[model samples]
Target: MQTLHYLTLSVLIPPLLSFFAEPGALFFEGGATNVGMIMDWREMAGRPTVRGMQGEDRWNAYYGAWSGGKQLGSGWVEGMWDGRTDPMRGWVIAFSWMFASFADIYYLCILVRRPRLLLDFALTLGFSHIVLTTYYSASIPTSLFFWIVMFTWSATTVTIAEQICVKREMTEGLVISPPRDEVDDLEMGELLRRD
Candidate 1:
């Protein structure tokens, strides 16, 4: 049950936060009125069919270089950037991920109150992303950049969470006083010793 809870939160939270961070790209058409960038769900999920195109045609349309002019079929179009093909959207997504990682520290350290499991939770989140991307894309992500980003995010989360948790644990109050009877007995012994 505990494992289930951890897995659920670790796997679900970051992506959900990312989506929320940039909802216009996912929900609004073309991300903006003039952008000509549409969220290609089929391409994102690695399905072969997209707007009556299939196989190589679908792949080319979605992943091919931008040629400009009214070509809504291609994922990369003029004035618009998908994270894969351009740096603008890539940076936006990176920021979103950073925000999510910060939230993870609060969730794991303060809310869940399990500082020791911070590393495990951070690793679980990274591994979950890999598994999810593979499942959705129907193939393992072969990009070196993707792996590097995942590692960086996980390492950062763990580092920050560990520091916060350690600080919290260190400042926690300690109970040094004995029970009432023990204190009375010690007092009486001290009195006798003094006599």
Candidate 2:
């Protein structure tokens, strides 16, 4: 659990600080770099019109998805992100991660045994980005935030699984062999034995 907590926080806290307190907006004012930011986002939404996409009225024809549930050019977008694209959008995305991280901190304090709660928190955080996106009027930052929460939650779940497996195995005093590629696993065995 200490390992999980440490790993979770490594990716968690900095983004939280950036989220609450705009990081480096001092220099990204509407300028060339900022223009690049706008271009980057448009290009992603612009792929449907590419030359090779001929006969493709919609990109959905390739993804096996219908246009109805598809979220197209309209949705919740954080108004705050538009004005300050570089640092602003960056900051909003960072804020989402920060919220996830802070939630992890809460999980550590309250749900150490009920790991399902940790998994739920991460998944909720990931999906929350979408809700927040809609609430913010459909924006790219929401997508980015979703990615952050997904990653954190996945990592937490993995750590929890490993810990549960290790505990179950240790009760029998069984010597489980480490994978061949995992040199670190040998050291982990020694460390776990000491515990």
Candidate 3:
């Protein structure tokens, strides 16, 4: 649920804003002005904020670039940073997606899984994807794919949490304890003994 809240609030907003904001691009070329706790304001120009639709950076990326580092467009993960500060936000976003994937798997491993928390995590993921989508419009298909995956994970987690909650309530209802009876008699007995 917390993750869902963040998904609805934090993670989702940036990308939605990026999509509409028109200026905040995701690729290296989409130079930006970031505002956050860790970030103040920056000016990144002539950098590859957005992946250009040309050259081997697109086609020969998978095969040729494996020797040193993965392509910069490798979703900013899988070896995409170039020792620049762009990773401040993109790297965190990429890492978040990675963390969310791990969490989704972890919840699946829970013995008595209540995956509602996964929804929040998935929401975080959705927003991360939204960030990617906002910047790399060309990468829409990939971002959209991940969004679908997040939704699937969310559905599973939410169902699990709901089940757990219902089961917990039922279990609490069935708890056995001494019944409440003869309260007035007990009170009268106590009062007479005190006198």
The lDDT values for all models are 0.52, 0.41, 0.41
- Report the candidate with higher TM-score, 1 versus 2: 1
* Tens digits of lDDT, candidate 3, 87-191: 244434333344444344444435324434545544565566456444544333333434444565456545555566566657767967555567677878999
Number of backbone-clashing residue pairs for each candidate, in the order shown:
0, 7, 14
Which regions of candidate 1 deviate over 4 angstroms?
1-71, 74-84, 175-195
Question: What is the overall TM-score of model 2 with all chains considered together?
Answer: 0.32
- Cα-based TM-score, every candidate: 0.52, 0.32, 0.32
Q: Over the full model, what C-alpha lDDT does candidate 2 score relative to the true structure?
A: 0.41
Using lDDT as the measure, which candidate wins? 1
Which candidate comes out best when scored by TM-score? Answer: 1
TM-score of candidate 3 to 2 decimals: 0.32
